[model samples]
Target: MSDEQQVGIVLVSHSGPVAESVVELARGLAAGGVTAPVAPAGGLPNGGLGTSAELIGRAAASVDRGAGVAVLVDLGSAVLTVKSMLADGDELPENTRLVDAPFVEGAVAAVVTASAGGDLAAVEAAASEAYGYRKT
Candidate 1:
């Protein structure tokens, strides 16, 4: 993939399984091998229901391919934790962004867009747009 399409993705949730499931679903939606790196940073180190800045920071770094990273969080705390993580550390890509979108739908949209060679902004927009999706 081109540099513009190499933007990575991070999924953060209070539950580990929830974050992982989103990754799985997004991967399944991808046409071929995932175009960008995707990782799940969820739960505390002890596996409890909580957010961890350390984990999120690491996940962001792990997926970063120099194109940037888009993080989708499930809860308010998740957002705070992710922000704190990114702020506290210098590991995340310089263009990393914490997206405001639904956990599952946003992840699905972001992953698909990223895999299709969309830039960071495009991928982020795709995730955010999920907020207006209708199920009629």
Candidate 2:
């Protein structure tokens, strides 16, 4: 990764506040504060409850700084929205990876890993591992 940028992350949720809060919380979890860009694409563009492909696509592209991005989403439709957006024509950076994991947990993991200078694959792996987390 370039010294100018580490891997970035995009958080997608149905509620704008939910996604924004996750980003805030994840930034705090970073060892020395978040070094990578983290963008939240949540809720409808009108501020209603929903997700928008255009917003998500913009968020992902905004965070990407040549190191690629890891997108963590909440709910099934958020995934579908992003997928459809990507398929529709908004081409993301080649290194972008859509990670399937628990939203809050995955966002925190991904942000921390990215802050630590991990590459796109490393960040995605960190997020994906959250799927197996147990609080027992």
Candidate 3:
């Protein structure tokens, strides 16, 4: 599926490297092939180890494709930053959703679903399922 029809993905983390690594891993793990836009929003602009609202906002805007955006956050403050943006109702693009799931797992699931041309709801569901994932 073309990127235009696939939901965009944003990975937010307190560490910049962690966010970027998750994006790379998710794209690599997508079975259907990743055609959707995925970007990493992490850390402060000065390379500190904390979430930044400005960076998160920019990343969401960067990957927006009119198909909606699935944002997966890696830490507590990261979630808060995203929530603030959502509450504002204007910091991000239209149809942007802050997915509540494990950072790495959710990001991979979201990308896989989006790669298969899944809509926002489907992608969110797939990612949410990761919340119950277990290894035994």
Best by lDDT: 3
Candidate 1 residue 19 C-alpha distance from true site, Å: 0.6
lDDT against the true structure, per candidate, is 0.86, 0.85, 0.89
- The residue ranges of model 1 lying beyond 4 angstroms of the native Cα positions read 1-5, 31-33, 86-91
State which candidate has the highest TM-score: 3
Model 2 bad stretches (over 4 Å): none
Ranking by TM-score: 3, 2, 1
Clashing pairs in 2: none
With candidate 1 superimposed using the best TM-score fit, by how many Å does residue 50's alpha carbon deviate from the native?
A: 0.3
* TM-score of each prediction: 0.89, 0.91, 0.93
> lDDT tens digits, residues 1-136, model 1?
4645488899999999988988998888765767778999989979999998778888888988888899999887998877776688675668999888888989989988888888888998999999898999
For each of the candidates, the C-alpha root-mean-square deviation to the true structure, in angstroms, is 2.0, 1.6, 1.8
**10 residues in a row with least lDDT, candidate 2:** 85-94
**How do all the candidates rank in terms of lDDT, highest first?**
3, 1, 2
| C-alpha root-mean-square deviation, candidate 2 | 1.6
lDDT of 3 by residue, 68-105 (tens): 99999987899888898899858899999999889899
What lDDT does model 3 reach? Answer: 0.89
TM-score result, candidate 1: 0.89
Lowest-lDDT window of 10 residues in candidate 3? 1-10
Q: Which 10-residue window of candidate 1 scores lowest in summed lDDT? A: 84-93
